[model samples]
Target chain A: MERILAILVKDRSGVLTRVSGLFSRRGYNIQNIAVGRTVEPGVSRMTVTVDADPLTVEQIVKQLNKLIDVLKVSDLTDEPAVERELILVKVKAEPGRRSEIQQMADTFRAKIIDLSPDSMIIELTGSEQKLQAFLTMMQEFGIKEIACTGKISLLRGSKVTCDMKI
Target chain B: MRLTGAQMVLACLEAENVEVIFGFPGGAVLTLYDEIYKKGFKHILARHEQGAAHAADGYARASGKPGVVIATSGPGATNIVTGIATAYMDSVPLIAITGQVATPLIGSDAFQEADITGITLPITKNNYLVKDINELPFILKEAFHVANTGRKGPVLIDLPKDLQAQEGEFYYPETVEISSYKPVYEGHAGQIAKAADAIKKARRPLLYAGGGVISSGAHEELLQLSKMMSIPATLTMNGLGGVPYDYEYFLGMPGMHGTYAANNAINESDLLIAVGVRFDDRVTGKLEDFAPRAEIIHIDIDPAEIGKNISVQIPIVGDCKLVLKELLRRLQPVEKTNAKKWCANVLEWKTSKPLHYSQEPGDYLKPQFVIEEFYRLTEGNAIVATDVGQHQMWAVQYYRSQKPRTLISSGGLGTMGFGLPAAIGAQVAFPEKQVICFAGDGSFQMNSQELATAVHYNIPVKIAIINNKYLGMVRQWQELFYGSRYAHTSLDGSPDFVKLAEAYGAKGLRVAKAEETAATIKKALEIPGPVVIDFQVDPEENVLPMVPPGTSIVEMIGGE
Candidate 1:
């Protein structure tokens, strides 16, 4: 089973290594991970997608809680949350197919961020499924390169993960 | 108040009330050592950094205080890795302070520079690399806090050389609130009730206690629970001292080298109340087959440990002492009549196939005989520390420990050279108590240089070397499973331990005959300072009541 964990940790050097190192050391499979500073100072939020069974996920959360730098971890997989992934796909666009790529991007609500003589960089942000669909459609034009900002998520309601008392 | 980083380190130790430290000095830690030289602290200089780490670990286990060790950078930091891993595996609270290269030269690969924090991240509960002077005092305080709290383990502080010399304001935090590391102290009420209900309903209940009982100081409660419910108890290797050996319901150790009674009791048990123990592979041979007839109720402080190996019917995550107290409060005391038949059955198995070894008049000295003699002489009162291998198992079999922390050994990591240094640590913790290091010939020589440390400090920790002339445990395995083709198991080139002891300015004794074992140990105990006794026992002797690897605990050989 795939699960998403929203982990808030102390913003310090080697903190990321501590988190990622834990996954590698404990033999947990990380599908993807996205980390960035939160609104508050000295704190960062990491959205880690892991592939594990329910039992293993419970162990993963408990083990993550044991790390000193980690502040909070919430399994947002089953929770009502807004999840998104950003990917920049540089498609090899010919002059004749440029309009076709633009139309495809428009349909997926993606942006044609950059256009070159030989390639067009399309920026897409949506649920993992939407992004994959957009990439599948763009494959016909040949993808020159692709960069993904794994996954980031936030709860839907007033119940804030960071505000919960340990 | 403003203080040098080194001075602040001492101030924090003073605040923490750390009476003594085991450490080695090097170029990176010179600044800290200089402060030590000027403002004196009780320090024991171990010959090797690894010995210092193990000594600190021993001190912590014996005293229930977080042990502290100091080392320099690179090689020095690496030397203590094994010791740190040992403490980590057994959940012993230890504070290891290692001097790192100067801050500017940290990543440049300067002389003696190593990424100590990164190296120790996996093994340590938590570790820090102090790059800023301002974070020094708080980090030190946090290191101690993390090491001592929850599921205690080693915490390392990699102090950069420049930071140790750099001056900073010293304000040790009175309390630390690590949001990520708040350990649950009380078990859930519902779960506790469920556990109580299970216990009440059980006809043949067994209590499988582990090192957690000692760590949480819940041994008394454990024994009380067993007595109140008329239940029998079995201990793991680290849990030896959790209950008095003479306790009528004590079924002795359970697992690979466990007694026939303990293993069979578990096999026949209706319910098992597991306290403060991880179901390690050695304890649960062939996990699915373990406790086949029982419903397991596991209570551990660490939530991750529960259901890790064996699924439990009831799981309680809390401190063992508090949970047991709650459990005791909830359940009504039962009369012995309730489990009389079950108790009689267990007692029958215990008496029928008791741990025994034959020693004829002209036979060579048996290792078991030496341990039994030590037990008689010490009267189950001494703090006995042991190195790994066959001697360790025999000590577990023969030495009856009556109190928590009495039997200290490398239960998890099984580090070979742990005994001598650990004994030194235990002795340092209690100057008046009798401390003995029951080491094997292959094990003692690993950190034998620490004999100098013992002599210099006059730490009267008797070393009882069960010189079997072979790595007895491995040889036993080869003999059983590998066609008795002993490959490089001999310790033939081992130096003379007694002469080695004498050269280090310590008393030395040798006992080659069965009759001489007890007298020699008595003589060693009477000596004022550290004494090393080399007991030449039968080399072919093997630790029995064996459970071959990947087999069920009930499937045992030589158990009867």
Candidate 2:
């Protein structure tokens, strides 16, 4: 199963390399990860999606907590949460299939953000489930290229009061 | 302030309030040692690298601070492997530094080109391979921080020769930001509640305390839990004296060679509240039959430690001190009821005299007599370090270690020849207190070269060698398991230890009779230059209270 973990860590040099290196060294496959500074400066929050089992995820969480700069980390699966992902795809739209591709993209609610005479750039944002459905539908449009920002999450309907200092 | 790597090392040492470091001179570390000489920091040059490592370990154990050790590259670096591994197993905070080949020649297998980082990894909590002097102060700062924190194990820094030679605009960071390592501090409320509920429900509860309790300084919390809930407590050898040995609820050290009282209580416990212990094989004889009737509640600071060995009903992963506080909080409203019947049941299993050496008017000295007399002389206040063997067991069984962190021994690793140098380290760490060492003849032979180090430093450490002809533990195993085959445990030929000590310019004494131990020890302590007393103990005697491998914890055979 693919699982995503949201980690809050003190932002510093080598922190990203250390965290990623740990995953690689342990041979725990990481599908993708999105990291950026949070509203609280000097603290970076990362969402790591890993192709691992529940036990392996647990082991990873425990091991990650052992590192020095990690402040507060939680695997969001066990609790109520909201998760989202974004994907941008550019597809070829030949005259023979231009109308067909636009109709297909419109069906998936993927806005044709940019359109030229021969191709369309489509942007989609939704829950991972909806995004997967849209991506599955877009496969019929003769896809040219795609880029995705992995899952980002927040606890559902509640504010997270994170007070840990590095 | 601008400084060199060597000067930064001094500053780092100053930050940690380090008083002395144990090391030996070599070409690579010459500049660093020269810096030490000019800066006026106390550094004792040991005869061998292992001796320096052990001395550092002893100092750390005695002072409750990380011990610092320095050595040059190649053979010198390799020499401390056993010592590092010993500290790793026993959780001693030793910041060890090794001079490596210059950064440019690191992987080329240059002269004295040992892969120090790779070589030392298995023995260290963590290691750093520094290629630049700019990172030196920061690394050293981090080294001290990491070495002295989070489980408190040895950390190594392999400093290359060029890195040491180069100067840097170095400043020590007040703190480091290591993003990957975040240790848990507070115990979860839910887990604490579950633990309290276990205590409330169980009829026979045992609080199994380990070294981590002492390390966390959780004695008061442990005392509260034991008294408030009427939980009987048993300590591992490392956990001895965490609670007063005289407490009604206190059972002695538990394990293979555990006291009858301790093993019996462990067997009878309905709820085993293991606090800060790893539950090593020594404690749990056979996995299946151990704690046969109990629901194990393993409360450890490390999450990975939970359920690593014994299955647990409640696994509380948090600091021992915090966990104990939460436990006390949970039990406040609960009424206290003494497990009087259960305590009495464990008491019935105790022997009249737990450690009695023969007073049958024999001339041959007994190892027990030396420790028993040592205990009497010091009143259990003096710190003791021992190498592995029958002598180490006798030190634990005989010496009443009333103070926390007083009894230092190589427990899990059981490294022979650890005593004398460790005692020197302990004495250096605590100059006001008396430090004693118990060494078996075989174990003494391993690091006896440090005797010269002791004399050179003029550290007042009392050394007592239990001079049996053979390696006592191996011989005991041979007797019991291999039909007394006695393959090669004995030291067939060796120099007389008394004569050897005399040659090293230290006071020496040889005891032939059991009656002579107290006087010999007293005289040794009184004399100035690192006294050595060779006790000619009986060769055939064994460290009894042996629980055969794969047997139940309660089924140990003890000496009457």
Candidate 3:
């Protein structure tokens, strides 16, 4: 089973290592993770996707809560939430096939962010499935480089993970 | 008031009411040492950083106060790793202050530089690397708070050399409020009610206690609950003092080397009220078959520990004392004879297959006999710290601890070289109390240099070395299961411990026969200074009532 956890932590040095170190030490598998500052200063929110069974997911949440730097941990796997992942992909482009690549990018609502003499970088942000579909289409054209900001998520309604009492 | 970082550290310790520190001085900690020298702080210079850490841990275990230790950079910091992990595993409250290379040289691999905080991340409950002088006071105070708080464990604060010299305004915080670190102190009312109902329905209820009872000061509450409910009780090795060994229904330490009664009760119990326990594999052999018939209610301060190793029917995340008190309040007292049949059955097992060893006159002294004799001579009034190996198990079997913190041994980490330094720490904590370090020849030699520290401080700690000339625990396994191919288990040419003690300006004695064991211990007890006793025991003796690995507790192999 795949479970997503939204963790709020103090913005301090070594906080990342502490969080990741915990995952590795506990043998929890992290599928993907994205971290960035929240609305509050000196606080960061990390969205982590993990592959584990239901029991393991519960253990993961409890263990994450044990870290002193982590302020909050919410399993948004069963909650109604919005998730997105962004990818910057440079695809090999020739003069003849450029328009076809642009059409595919347009269909996926992606933008051609950077252009080179023989290649172009397309910026795309969407749910995991949409990103995967975009990548499959770009595979036809050689993907020269790829950078992904792993999935980041938030609850759909007024409910916020940080405000949820532990 | 304006104060240098070193002074600020002292201020925080003073604020926390730290009475003494176990530490060693080095180049990186020169500034802190200078402050200590000028300010006249109480410090015991240990021969090794590991000794200092264990000493601090022993002090903490004995005094119920978090112990403090200081070390220098690189090798010094790494030396305390085993000690830190030992405390972390046993849930001992300890604070380790390590001096790091100056901030400017931190990542450049400067002289004697090591990433102590990074290295200790997995071992420490929490740790900090002070990058700014202003954070020193708060970090030190927080280190103490975190170390002693719920599910107590070791916390480290790495101070850079330059920061220790930098002057800053010092204001120790009166309270710590880590948003991520709030501990639940009270169990849920509904859960307590449910547990009470379960207790009422249980005919063969058993109470299992662990180190948490000692850490939370819940021994009295645990005893009260057991008495009120007429329940049979068993203890983990770390929970030795949680219940007096002589209690009528108290089963001996339960695990691989557990007594016949303890293991049998755990196997047959209908309800297991496990408090302050983590269901360690040692305590729960072959987990799938452990207490198969029982419904377990686990109460611990740490939520993650509730169902960590074994499934729990009712999980309560709260202080053990508070939870036990609440359960006691909710349940009406049961009749004294409610579990008459069950209690009789347990007592029968206890008496039928009691712990025993046969040592004819003029035979090599049995380790068990020496411990039992010491226990009788001391009247079970002394605090006993033990080093790891077969001797540790033997002491655990024969020397029954009657009070919390009285049995100070490295339970979780099982680290060798813990006994002598730990006893020194305990002696330092209570100079008037009788503190004995029961060590093996192999274990004593690990941190044996600490006799110098003990002698210098006049800490009259007794060292009773069960000298078997081999790593008895490993040798036992080889003899039983490994075709008797004893690899490096032999301690072939270990130094004469008595000579080593005399060389360190401490008294020394040797007891090769069973007849001299009690007299030697009595004489050592009267020395009023540090003394070491080497008791030459049977080299191949094994701790019995043993449950082979991956087997059910009910299928124990020995002590029939």
Best by TM-score: 3
Q: State the lDDT of candidate 2 residue by residue for B52-119, as single tens digits.
A: 99999988887788899999999889998889998988788999999888888878988887877677
Off by over 4 Å in 1: A164-166, B336-338
Residue pairs that clash (backbone atoms under 3 angstroms), model 3: none
Candidate ranking under TM-score, highest first, comes to 3, 1, 2
The C-alpha lDDT values of all candidates are 0.93, 0.82, 0.92
lDDT for each residue of candidate 1 in B1-560, tens digit (9 for 90 to 100): 98888998899999999999899999999999999888889999999999999999999999999999999999999999999999999999999999999888979999998888999999999998888889998998899999998999999999988888899888999998776778899999999999999999898999999999999999999999988898999999999878899999998899999999999999999999999999999999999899999999999999889887888999999999999999999999876565889999999999999888988778999999999999999888999999999999999899988889999999999999999999999999999999999999999989999999999999999999999999999999999999999999998889898889999999989999998887788888999999999999999988889999999999998998
DockQ of each: 0.69, 0.21, 0.68
Q: Across all candidates, what is each one's fraction of true contacts kept? A: 0.81, 0.41, 0.74
Write the number of the candidate with greater DockQ, choosing between 2 and 3: 3
Ranking under DockQ, best-scoring first?
A: 1, 3, 2
TM-scores of all predicted structures: 0.97, 0.80, 0.98
lDDT per residue as tens, model 3, B1-560:
89999989888888888999999999899999999998799999999999999999999999999999999999999999999999999999999999999988999999899999999999999999998898888888788888888899999999999999999988888887787888899999999898999999898999999999999999999999888888989999999989999998898988899988998898899899999999998899999999988999999999999888999999888999999999998888867454888889999999999998988898888999999988999999999999998999989899988999899999889999999999999999998999989999999999999999999999999999999999999999999899999999999999988899999999999999998887888899999999999999999888897999988888887859
Per-residue lDDT for A1-166 in model 1, tens only?
9999999999999999999999998899899999998887888999999999989898898888888889988999899999999999999998999999889999999999998899989999999999989889998999989999999998898878677444
- Error (Å) of candidate 2 at residue A121 is 33
> Which prediction has more favorable lDDT, 1 or 2?
1
Q: In candidate 1, which residue pairs get closer than 3 Å at backbone N, Cα or C atoms, i.e. clash?
A: none
Error of 3 at A73 (Å): 0.1
What TM-score does model 1 achieve against the real structure?
Answer: 0.97
C-alpha root-mean-square deviation, each candidate: 1.6, 6.8, 1.3
TM-score of chain B of 1: 0.99
